[model samples]
Target: MLNGERLTGTGRSKLTAALALAFLGAVTSVSGTSAQSAVPKPGASVFTTDIAPILQAKCEACHRAGSSAPMSLRTYEETRPWARSIKARVSRREMPPWHIDKTVGIQHFKNDISLSDQQIEKIVSWIDAGAPRGDPNDMPPAREWGNGEQWNIGEPDLVVMSPKRVVPAHGPDWWGDLEVDPQLTEDRWIQAIETKPVGVARRVVHHAGTTLIQPDGARESLSEFAVGKYGDIYPEGAGRLLRAGSKISFGVHFHSVGEELPVVIEVGYKLYPRGYVPKHKVTEVNVGVINGHLFDDLDIPANSVTRHEAFAKLEKAARIISYQPHMHIRGKAMTMDAIYPNGQAQTLSSVDRFDFNWHVAYVYDDDYAPLLPAGTILHTVGIHDNTAANRLNPDPNQWVGFGNRTFDDMLQCHVLLYYMDDAEYQQQVAERQAKKKSQTTQNQ
Candidate 1:
């Protein structure tokens, strides 16, 4: 299962079909039962028929072998021991790892994999009933995983391997840059990219990004990999430019787990051929003011919850694609909104409870994508908790500010967008003005 890909195209159709079938099957089972009937008794038999399907659909993608999850729950034997743990996490709405607040904004998403409240109830009841393994025959057919070490999006046009490096034991976290030549003969537009940590290095690797190294030593991030994200997959007809002769560098941050380790990492890119022009040129903007301004400086006093904000005004009309909120530890919540020139405001995305480890880009569904006029203001609000209640906080007694280190804090609102051309942008501006005039006349 591709956990992080945009849930459109053939994928959504297939999912819809599967869901229809599941609904029909469910209807047959509940035909004789009242809507308010008692919750079904939990047992091993219940585990096989009810609980297992939920796990397969919601949890197994990351919980299986050779994945990011700490344990494999592919079988009854494997999952039996962790029944209570699973119940606790799902009961708290933490397992499926989706952070966006569903009620505050647009409620449609292609990649939402969170469990429903009923599903959570079923799992909790099953665990309370002793997590019995009733029958192997009741298990849903096994799911197939990605081929060994293969990219989930399939074979890439180019692959670059980073030089192997050693991580010292009992040392501070390390940030290293590795330059690898992609040896491309011409420029290409990248559709998707993935980074793989080979050998034992996967355990200690915090995050890695593939960047384009400039002649003057500056670098631009192209793709990234982290704990919960599979890779960078753009929406349909969208891509990022990769220049010819550019050296691909991996900006790797590795955290020490109290042991020395050696590891090798590789990055793979799926590309559009040369001369292939994309419909949308995708770009990401990080909005913030860091020079001690209340909104950008991001100062969080100890034992208090603080909120800061930033704004980005668009010079071109653009379609908003996604928003990825970033913070180290102590991050609590974030909300992003688009303010049109006419003073109308709408929330684009809001994460009420932010998790540093389960970071993901919340991509808008095609029909729900927001188009902003040239002068629209993109505003971001970020909240941080520096109290001791924040378990990940290193020191609640000390104030926190923006920095690269883990103990220090950062608040970033990274928005992905596709800018409209001059003619189309102008047309949109005129249309908006006309609509505003029409509304004012009606009000009068």
Candidate 2:
């Protein structure tokens, strides 16, 4: 099923719908319980013992007070009222907001917040059992979180703010670039970077993309912030270069939110210790719609579902660190594949349910990150639904095309990777092969 409903589109869509149904069936069977059998017994005590721990580990990060989530789930009092909502969301695999399809493609990630099948079952069972508080002593210690003002990347070594802009109560979307000086005296390596719209600006800002302008006039994309994105934290031994005497530019996209508001974009950079240089420099590659063109022939008819495919060929051997699918409201799903020179193709990642509210970049674990040789082609297939079935669709009767506004449509994927020489690539491939063999043997 595509978005929990059968699709009556092309042959491929029918096949995808069949596969999705089969996958859901497999998941339900593997959990060793049917929907009726999975219901909890009356008066079962599950909240403090089973459900609380799961929430603490998975949900509380964002669902706690001062976080972005609408309500806090830190205690039974704060959570009891939302029990039914939680059950519905978790049963649909929509809560905690991890949208990557688990049945296919790479399964491991460094920052995966998705709950397991057993965890989902537990949450549903608890809610059905009346969401009891049970023994208070069984509750685990509360997880500590920084105040709302704290940066996600921890205390940053440097912080910069963009020039303030006033967004009108109602107007056309605004797009402009604002530049700020970092005033660095010496070169530094960036370990992590975060960008956010301050206060009420979060409601109006669609995205704030920061770029680094070097003293020599060269520019590099530093980091970006969307609604659901956290921050970019480079893996160990890899970092982005920040030259001395560099200025930062903020490319802000603001949409009116029914109230006039003044907005400022804040950027934070966590730096590597002085005198330390990273082995690999991280770079971002954006695979745009229909063969690398950002806004070329992206037409979606009213009340129809359309699919667009894009391809990018690598000029150098590289290790892909993350995959972030980008689209507007009409976006339904996206799948990324890597076609090697020898003609073998592998699906690296697939976001089956692409929610525009959550623009997450799934970061691969170091060992599982794809190592591709030069000439490998990255293929991306994005699906867009301009029909009433897409609840996020602003107007199903309006044909959508490429534009900067949220109502219009665009298709793209952001891939973060570090290029390497042929020798290093070969060595890494061999190491990965050996590691896989060892894992297989251990499992046997």
User: RMSD, model 2, all Cα superposed?
Assistant: 7.8
| lDDT (0 to 1) per candidate | 0.73, 0.80
Error of 2 at 270 (Å): 3.0
**Model 2 lDDT, residue 156, Cα:** 91
Cα error of candidate 2 at position 425, Å: 0.5
Model 2: per-residue Cα lDDT over 176-231, one tens digit each: 89999968889999999999888777767777889899999977677888655678
For model 2 the TM-score comes to 0.80
In angstroms, the error of model 1 at 301 is: 1.6
Give one digit per residue, the lDDT tens place, for model 1 in 1-444.
121112223332355334433433432222111311224453323667888888888888778765546667888767765554565567667688888887798656656778887888877766555565555697889987645366866798888889888887757667778888867678789898888787567766777777777545655566766654566678778998777778888878886655688867888889987789898898877766432344446789889989888888888889877777877788988899989889999998899879875556777775566778888898888999999777567788898888877778888787878899768767756776787689899999
For each candidate in turn, the TM-score is 0.78, 0.80
